[model samples]
Target: EPEVTQTPSHQVTQMGQEVILRCVPISNHLYFYWYRQILGQKVEFLVSFYNNEISEKSEIFDDQFSVERPDGSNFTLKIRSTKLEDSAMYFCASSEETLDQPQHFGDGTRLSIL
Candidate 1:
């Protein structure tokens, strides 16, 4: 089965540096989402995109963040400036239809901001 894949399973960066987290969503899915989980917190939705434009974004997706489908297969999230609070497991997910359907998640890119 096709599955979402994320790069650099773990990443450590200093505060204020830019970081680009990469993912390849399932080939046939139209809805993609980004979510984050702080150490022991519940998963929080960051943003969702479809048709090359943002469909929805949570308050957590502030000015420092942006996402793009750089190619037919790759999706990326860029953080203009990282903060300590940004440390979390950033998960990339995709579903065949909508949020009502179950989403498949990558192992995740663990961003560690220090």
Candidate 2:
């Protein structure tokens, strides 16, 4: 079955550098999201996108972060400047148009900043 997929499963980056985490959601899904798990903390929602526009975003998604659907099949999350506190497991998810549908998540991209 088709599922969400992420690239560069493990990313190690330097502080103040830029990082872009990539994701490919299920082909037919209509809604997309980006979330992060900071070490032992709960998963936090970053943003949601649909029809190439941001549907909603959390306060944690500050000016340093951005999301895009650069093409038909790929969705991406970019951190303009990496910080040590930014280290986390970033997950990409998607769901069908219906709100009741469960969102499918990728294995996640583990980002470690130093």
Compare the candidates by TM-score and give the number of the best one.
Answer: 2
Report how far off residue 70 is in candidate 2 (Å): 0.6
lDDT of 1 by residue, 15-50 (tens): 999999999999999999999999999999999999
At residue 23, give the lDDT of candidate 2. Answer: 99
Task: Candidate 1: give its CA RMSD in angstroms.
Answer: 0.9
Model 2 lDDT tens row, 1-114: 998999989999999999999999999999999999999999999999999999999999999999999999999999999999999999999999747889899999999999
Clashing pairs in 1: none
Which 10 residues in a row give candidate 1 its minimum summed lDDT? 94-103
Provide the overall lDDT of each model, using Cα atoms, as 2-decimal numbers: 0.95, 0.96
Q: Tally clashes: model 2.
A: 0
TM-score for each of the candidates: 0.97, 0.97
* Runs in model 2 lying further than 4 Å from the true structure: none
